[model samples]
Target: MQEFIPHRKCVGCMSIKPKKELLRIVRTDKGIFIDSKQKMPGRGAYICKDLECLKLAMKKKGLEKSLKVNISKDFYEKLEEFLKKLAVKSFDAEVWE
Candidate 1:
């Protein structure tokens, strides 16, 4: 039997993709966080790894709507920085399986 792969929708591009191919951001009681392990508890939303998608999410307020929280400008800046670092490291080696 074939394994069943999970799929999730990207809040930015509004495209459905394999869960592993996207990044997950979660909102918990404590605060919002980037769930790299995809195991964080709370309300979670998915987004494409591409920077363009991030921009789209910001422009459209996709993440905010999905998470039901008002995201701050500073948080977006931090998220952008994190994504930039992720982009750089991704090219070095295939970290995600």
Candidate 2:
């Protein structure tokens, strides 16, 4: 038997990619936060690490619909900032490319 690799779809790009390649956003009773470890409980949505995908997801309200909750503007701003920081720390370069 072969090991299975999980796959997830990006809410922004609608592209299917390996789970490890995407970022997970989870909505829990407490609030919404990026699930860096993909271990949070509650509804989850995936998005590409690229900022463009984040913009598209926000514009399309995909996260809101997927999480079945109203997302505030401040949350979006915070998510963007978090992603930017993660990109910086992970790649040590701009993620736009």
Candidate 3:
């Protein structure tokens, strides 16, 4: 089998990082969701495992810009809520789903 080292771009900072170094957020047929495992089927975007990165993505409208879809404030609120519940540490690893 060929060795694979996947690279994905951080939606917040637009920096390319190793897949394991970032988190995946996806919008699927069911609904908008976080894909922590990065194995879900959907249009996925990578992000840093930091709230500030999320905030940057939001403030820059990076998600909508990249996803090519409209996202409402409710979606942002939901993401914030989920993140709060997860109690993510500053440098802890995470997968959104």
lDDT of 3 by residue, 35-96 (tens): 77777898887778667888999999888887777888887887776667666456333533
By lDDT, the best candidate is 1
Model 1 accuracy (lDDT, Cα): 0.87
What TM-score, over all chains together, does every model reach?
0.89, 0.86, 0.76
Which parts of model 3 are misplaced by more than 4 Å? 1-3, 84-97
lDDT of 2 at 94: 28
lDDT of each: 0.87, 0.84, 0.77
Q: Tell how far residue 68 is off in model 2, in angstroms.
A: 1.0
Q: After superposition, how far is residue 14 of candidate 2 from its true place, in Å?
A: 0.4
* Model 3, residue pairs in steric clash: 34-97, 35-97, 36-95, 36-96, 36-97
lDDT by residue for model 1 (1-97), tens: 9999999999999999999899898999988888878987999999988889999999999999999999999878877877787878554223432
lDDT of 3: 0.77
Q: Residue 97: error of model 3 in Å? A: 6.5
Model 2 residue 7 lDDT? 100
Q: Note each model's CA RMSD in angstroms.
A: 3.3, 4.6, 3.6
Error of 2 at 49 (Å): 0.7
